[model samples]
Target: MTTTETPGADTVRPRWGAERIGNAIFAAVVFGLGVFALVGAFAIRVPAGQAIGPQVFPFAVAVILLGSGAALVISALRGQVAPREEGEDIDPDAKTDWWTILKLVALLVAVLLLLELLGWWMVAALLFGGVAWTLGAKRPWVAFLVGLVIGIGTQLLFGEGLGLFLPRGAAFDWWYGPGPLFG
Candidate 1:
């Protein structure tokens, strides 16, 4: 196939634009991750006399990551990159809402810390409510109620129905008693 090139396209170094630099950095990260995965997979122990050991999946994953990362790095180095998004992109001139971002991040950290003590249900509810409130929900109380329902429902579904080990609240042991509710 005939390949067409613009004037000076055969230059040794492609233009070091922001997009190209970002793409190259991302590609390098992926390549580094692939190397890490491959090395970790080699460290995995294979059980004796097993037809398909645990290492099989890890090795397969490593190969896929390595191949994809190598391809990305090559494409990036060649200055063949892709746009992040297609249509309806965010306005470039618009200022970032740092307050909202900070609140949401704080909420996430709080949830992570309180997950064990307050339980998944309470943490999930708080997280949902906090996020909704931060995002300017019309009714914050209603959002909290909805969050509560969601938390209980998810706990019942994943914890009770699916038999997953979801906490029943360490702080509120009186509410859950000995075993999980409906478990």
Candidate 2:
């Protein structure tokens, strides 16, 4: 309930709580993403003679996102802020680690940049391992191997089993033969 006086102003402004600000931002992002999803869903081309098109799932997801976002915004506006963590391993007094956050961001950026060049299988493995390491994985090599398996497995599942296209970069084209292994 404490208020801070503005410089060169007699009027005082109540400080906005972090929870409220975070909730508002989260709501806005979710709502924006929902709208984007809806737009994208509508833009998808429906093949002739298909009763249920690919847009159906995206539309459903968009509706859910919109509803959840609206609910979150309303709850936040009503001052029903999220509860703080009470974890045993957490230190409440510890300051935010900007460096770790930066590392994670950099890793994600690397993955994005390399996705088309190195393909989903290679880049996804790197991404998964990088994230695991950044989050303090005990055995990074094991994590990397597991991530590699997951990446390759997913590629096979989507590309071969499901007949879905996934990026297979030019660098590994030799291994993939004359035709593209994935879409």
Candidate 3:
């Protein structure tokens, strides 16, 4: 097979470039995600005799995503792609920090794995501390302490104040009767 290269074609037809195709594909993915969110939003159960429920926020977010996705899709199809961001602090030629990304991903996986066993607060603290330490925190112990405080505070705020209880510790729950650990 022989591929012919048309000289000056790229300069003449900038609209049909690789960036345009990538933008369109990204927009399509966003639109698909919006559709998924909309379906999930509709699946949420509303309490009987209540006007507004938890579904309201999801529905609103779904609508926003859908609209934005649609707009992006149209813009991309018309070759009106967004301009590349070039911040003063950013190095254009800098290589991606894959090591940092890998560490973050590993930490997230650990959080997911330990969420039920260690409980939300403990896992949250671990995640925060891990991220802080990964990002060059001088005092990792202090970071862990702060993460613990934040984790416990969120647990209290959501579980006690808002009545949205997180799992207390699945293993502990099985052993110590399903009562909440903190209230």
Candidate 4:
């Protein structure tokens, strides 16, 4: 018999039981939701004179989710744990860089504040630039331009063309005449 020696072999150990238990619990919760959805589909009445109602689609989705969740639970019970190719124990409370989160939150807040003052185009542009910069973007001006295009483009297409009443900001009044649009 031949044995191969590996450097730093003493540090490697199998994952703890808690991770497996946590995963099992998550699987169980998903399974329970699936069951709930499946049951809910039958609890509601289908409207008369409708060939395909809401109940049918929800029921089909629920059944599919139920089957998949059941399969996952069964696989977990059969000792088929998720493979940890990286050899690191999955810790839920692990530290992640919060800069992106802060940036996104700031963006949301800025958007809300600037919506009435600067309008969707300017607000979205500012938010996108800020977020991109915070997330290590090298060119924030590009992000700003992209954000402006996307924000105003959506409004023009959905709100103006399709006649959807998306919320407009005070800047809309300043840029164009009264009553919500440029047309």
Candidate 5:
């Protein structure tokens, strides 16, 4: 068929372009997140005598999100399209490994479910080791041991140094009094 006589050749252009639609979606998500963060930040109770309160960081993050979202929406309406990305290491045709993804998801769920029962120290170790194994670590035992040390160290750091409480299982309490090692 001739170009001039092609089907729907004189149709009206779409109201919004693909780039605008994508940018609008991105802006909506970002703006929604900003609103959520703002609400959460406002819910935090500011402690007395503190120059910078706990809400400061969250508020700042919310503001940044709001600003960026607005900028994106404005840019989209102005017909500013983003340039396509080009990278050396990216394999455009590579397919995702569903099995590996499912394994990682299962590990995460297991860790979450076991956290209260096994405690942060044990669960964190398992999480690290499990992740390493899922990612094809040759020596899982060594990874587990290293993860165990890191877990214990992190427990001590957060629980003792930062005064943040992490779960300590009943077994741990029975072995080391009512409180865990650093509790």
Candidate 6:
């Protein structure tokens, strides 16, 4: 068949071309997560006590995700998304920078691992500077300063102001002692 006489020639054109594929993928993931969460709830026992249990929140969130995922998938398949009007000022470079984002995520995971061995201040500092540097921050000193400040500041805020505990790191354990706060 010619391009002009294609099978879907009479249908309305989708306003957002990329959104169709994106929404379908998003829907599948959300639906899968919802199903998993709902299934996980079965492993927990209610214990016949309070109005709700730990499984309640997960179950509810799962249901909502499932419903929304279904709707998004259906809308995407039907091409029912509204089109952007003509001459709209859309940013051409608004797409996801996967490599940068992945680097940042890797930095975050490293920070989490380092937190147990390096302490709150040290890990926080590293996390801050590392993430920034990984994401192409040019100023190393600035990133370091920012990381240090954030790490120490958050440590003080959570440990002192909020009275929440923080790990003192493995170094602290070897130097001072081992405890829940220090461990």
Which candidate's lDDT is highest?
2
The ten-residue window of minimal lDDT in model 6 covers 174-183
CA lDDT of every candidate: 0.82, 0.84, 0.83, 0.75, 0.82, 0.76
Best by TM-score: 2
Residue pairs in collision within model 3: none
Residue 17 of candidate 5: its Cα lDDT?
A: 71
Q: Write the per-residue lDDT of candidate 2 for residues 1-183, one digit (tens) a residue.
A: 999987747543334588688888999899888999999999999989999988899999999999999998887776667767779998877889998899999998998899888888888889888988998999887888888898889998987788776788768877888764565
Residue-wise C-alpha lDDT for candidate 4, range 88-113, written one tens digit per residue: 67665666678778778978887887
Evaluated at residue 7, the lDDT of candidate 5 is: 77
Task: Give the CA lDDT, 0 to 100, for residue 179 in model 2.
Answer: 65
**Which 10-residue span in candidate 3 carries the lowest summed lDDT?**
174-183
TM-score of each candidate structure, all chains considered together: 0.60, 0.83, 0.73, 0.50, 0.62, 0.54
lDDT of 5: 0.82
CA displacement after TM-score superposition, residue 135 of candidate 5 (Å) = 1.0
Candidate 6: C-alpha lDDT: 0.76
Clashing pairs in 4: none
lDDT tens digits, residues 62-87, model 6? 89988987887787777666454455
For candidate 1, lDDT tens digit of each residue in 69-175?
A: 88988988888757555457766556679999999999999988898899888888898889999999988888888888989899999899987667766788876
Using TM-score, rank the candidates from best to worst. Answer: 2, 3, 5, 1, 6, 4
Off by over 4 Å in 6: 1-18, 27-98, 174-183
CA lDDT of 181 in candidate 1? 79
Question: Alpha-carbon error at 87 in model 4, in Å?
Answer: 12
